[model samples]
Target: MKTKATLLAFLLAAPLWCIAASSYPEQVFQPEIVIYFGDKIGLTDEQREFIVSEVTTAKDSAREDKYRLNVEMAKLRRLLDKTITGEEEAEKQIKRLFEVENALKMANLKLLIRVKNQLSVEQRKQLRELMKDFNPKKIGPSEEVEKRLQAKIEKLKKGMREMVEIGVNPENISKVTAKFQPLINAAKYKEAEEVLDQAIKMLDDPF
Candidate 1:
């Protein structure tokens, strides 16, 4: 009886764990502009089709680069912790980490450039706006709404540089925790609305 109960509990928990792991925490490709353009801008079925495919390709490429770099950084951090002894080794680790970070930024920027080239000026604006909305890994509210947040992003870059001069990262867990929680809790919850424009294109299966 005890063994059977333990097995049943494991089976029940396994599905929940899988669901949690598989679900996108902040974003799934629920493109809002896709629906809007289909309905309001009257995108032909073909244009809709091409845009959906292009957008997915760009997003996936960006995500892959981000994940790959994060994994690399984690491995490097463990190696540094285990073996690095002096300031020189630490400096080398930091340099390699920064290079990897810059590469990832360049890759994402190139993908964004491709996205911009593929989209019309107006559509590109809408796409950015849509990305700001649906992209749940958001740093904070929209730049339009958060001048302080925007300024702080720049400030953080400057601060990071200064910290590097003094051999620090300036990444304070307590400070970061204090910075975002108020915004997170006070912000209104918005539901993800379907993108009809993408859906019309999705009739043919772009992903």
Candidate 2:
């Protein structure tokens, strides 16, 4: 009975584990982090321009890969739904899905690496110091803080909905909010606020 309970618990939590695993690794520096703290970090004009350019190019390039990934995922789901799938075909689809995901991951890593290379050691240190405040482990369970963050998230969601209603691309809004949800779920409220702020700014002035 205990073993069965453990197995059931694992099955129930599997999707959450997968989501946490697939999210941007905490150690990796997102371009939004640099952009948000640019003034405090004293980012040079050149550094800022390079980071933005690389991130923009990466997002554009990943669009096709993202589409392919979605299609592959759908194909795999359909295959799994069938009672007697061809093992070889199922394996091929899984491999293709992994390849697309890997390509997207590699492109993002390369972009971040280039951005990091552009920053001076002192600037990087400054960013690290600024980011310390958002570290989930360091934050206390303050009710006030939790309420504020939750309110901000709700407001942002409303704004995003409004944008979509006014013809803004829903996919663009979704891409930004995707990371935000996981952070919020993990009680990384400070980081979630930062992400939502940056997402709103990006959607408002996408150029």
Candidate 3:
């Protein structure tokens, strides 16, 4: 009877322990990254081009304002850490920090608002579908699919680096989408799908 009770306890607890061990916080919020509208939408080729260009413009402008604010905040933090003996000086620094933080918050909000304005309802739904993470570990990456995905990822990284260096938005995300369309149409959709995933990840990268 004691042995039977022990076995029942082990059986009941094993699945619960497995689930607890695997559960983890998957969502992370990072403000500096540009989470693209394309990340959420199933864009028509034309829409992708227009949206990408619009977002790139908004983001570049936002980045300039954000950089200055960040510098000021860093200075304020340094001042706080120093040996400040006077209440007047401490109060001034605190005020400056709050002002800078508020400005940064507003700048980010404006950018998000602008991005939202550009997206249509259908596009928004598509974006949600695209942004979902595909866990290859659970889904099992086929060797052929993996190879194609890597190629697509490399291409996207190159394009992103070039955009940053040359200060040019890919005139249209449609161009990139069009470039992939043939491959997708040919039934090599895994590669194109994987490339689209890579593009979203690149846009999300903090740096």
CA lDDT scores, all candidates in order:
0.45, 0.68, 0.49
Candidate with best TM-score: 2
Query: What would the per-residue lDDT of candidate 3 be over residues 114-160, giving only the tens digit for each residue?
Result: 55555676655554454466332332246787686667667676766
Candidate 1, poorest ten consecutive residues by summed lDDT = 188-197
Query: Model 2, 120-194: lDDT tens per residue?
Result: 888877777787666443433378877876776787778778877887765765777788755543335677778
Stretches of model 3 off by over 4 angstroms after superposition: 1-42, 125-207
* lDDT: the better of candidates 2 and 3: 2
Query: lDDT of model 3 at residue 106?
Result: 58
RMSD of each: 22.9, 10.3, 16.5
* Candidate 1 residue-wise lDDT, 158-206, digit = tens: 5556556876544452244243433232231111111222222322332
lDDT of 3 at 207: 37
